[model samples]
Target: MTNKLSAGLAALFSLGTGPALAAQPVDWQMGFQPAATEIMTQIRGFESYTLWFIVPITLLVLVLLIYVMVKFRAGANPNPSKTSHNSLIEVIWTLGPVVILLALAVPSFNLLTAQYSPPEADFTVKATGYQWYWGYEYQTDEELSFDSLLLQDGERADAGKEDLATYPRLLTVDNEFVVPVGKTVRVLVTAADVLHSFAMPAFGIKIDAVPGRLNETWFNAEAEGLYYGQCSELCGKDHAYMPIAIRVVAQDKFDAWLAAAADDVEAANRNLIAAIDADAKSVDVAANVKN
Candidate 1:
């Protein structure tokens, strides 16, 4: 046990201080959210505090259980103490739990407030969950919208051979939610059909997508990469089909993408208006000739 414990500690320390520490373990999808930024730091702090409370309490209980079984067995203690009503022990037990709870609640409450606190978000996105797909809208920006559907097996294979540098099958989407890194993005989640959950584990966000109700969550990704998640709630037969892919790009890339989306929406609207006007003009000319 001693050797095993020491070896485990050594391994943990080594990984924590490895040479490639600067490079996050995104390739393997192994590392925790890098808390170098303030928001992520708050999340990491909550996780660490919870672990601290859980680990020692679990160990202490396990050790005490083992010690009692081994040292105070039936044979060892033939005559057991029959005193069951001790006010002092009761008070200690009661107060001990209360004190431990207070210790946990203090930080837990603070973290909850921080997580739910609304910030002056840089952007807003409304994610609409469909039966087996997603639709995203740039709520605060131009009236741009897009539908994201899962790739079929053959489609995924072709994409892998052609667009390998982009993304993989289960993680890839027809449309990606693009955002600038280091910006607080407020995501308004809802469903168009059945119930689903918008969950991104790395961002530590999981909110239900209920029809006729909007759920909200926020995240500020400080690094640039493609993060993937799926519809967490079991909605229907193809619940697994709906996936969420977000691309966090550099500020410049994000700006470019935004401008492009805006331009596309504008062009589409202009073409639509022109077509309507041409139809109206042709109708008027035809009516004049008939008269």
Candidate 2:
């Protein structure tokens, strides 16, 4: 029974921290993914602020509705009050919404400004959306370029990553967009064919990929891990299959990966997977020690 209880607690803990473990949507996930960047943190804060207003307002309206239904029933009040309008109530309702709007507007505008006004980028990457895939070009120094395609189930099995933990269904890709952690990355987003949206939920980035027009967005991921997104816009029949995977690593690891990828992408991916596995094992061992 003790062992069973411990296992149950562990499962619950894992469920609670699932979003943090992977920057992808999980079953029964209602809120945003664990924030990986400063913009996402601000986004979450604004959401919380809106929720504070929404919850109380909704509850108050509900209570008022219940009170009116109970107190103003036909049997309770035979003579209905002919009062059409209360000036004080009207004034309060009008001014109350205005105040709420103003409160919301301040933060909303600030968040928009922060998101649009990116810091001087440490590096720039150009993302071009295709009909069924994404192409990434490192525009800074090395001028490395590659196309990322969604990895099929069979391909995942061939890569020996059939487990959902490693290669999530419909989310994993052949080539992940790699970047260094804690550095501002400006992404110039465009499209070669139909429209697509370059979105990363954890990074709070979602910009349109319009053909012949480059839309810019930026993110500075603070943690090193694998984050997943998808083409948010409906481009074609295979829009669902166009997955976006980003791997944030340390500067040295990124440098090595970039160099290797420029030479041979397959070898570089294998090396990255090995390094990720090693890092995961070390973390697990440290957790076990603490336990």
The TM-scores of all predictions, comma-separated, are: 0.73, 0.88
Candidate 2 contains a number of clashing pairs equal to: 0
In candidate 2, which residue ranges exceed 4 Å CA deviation? Answer: 1-21, 157-160, 282-291
Give the alpha carbon lDDT tens digit for every residue of 1-291 in model 2: 665666556644443222225688888999999999999999999999999999999999999999999999999999999999999999999999999999999999999999999999998999999999999999866768999999987798555456687479999988899998899999999999999999999999999999999999999998877899999999989999999999888788889999899888877987877776666565545445545
lDDT tens readout by residue for model 1, 1-291: 665666555544433222111222256664474553455577777788878879998998999899999888999999887987999979988998899899989988987898799688998999999998888899755667887787665765433323444455566665567777789999999999899999776676779999999999998876655567789999999997788877665576566566666667333323432333354455545444544
Give residue 160's lDDT in candidate 1 (0 to 100): 31
Q: Which candidate is the best by lDDT?
A: 2
Among these predicted structures, which one has the highest TM-score? 2
What residue pairs clash in candidate 1, if any at all?
none
TM-score between model 1 and native: 0.73
Clashing pairs for predicted structure model 2, backbone only: none
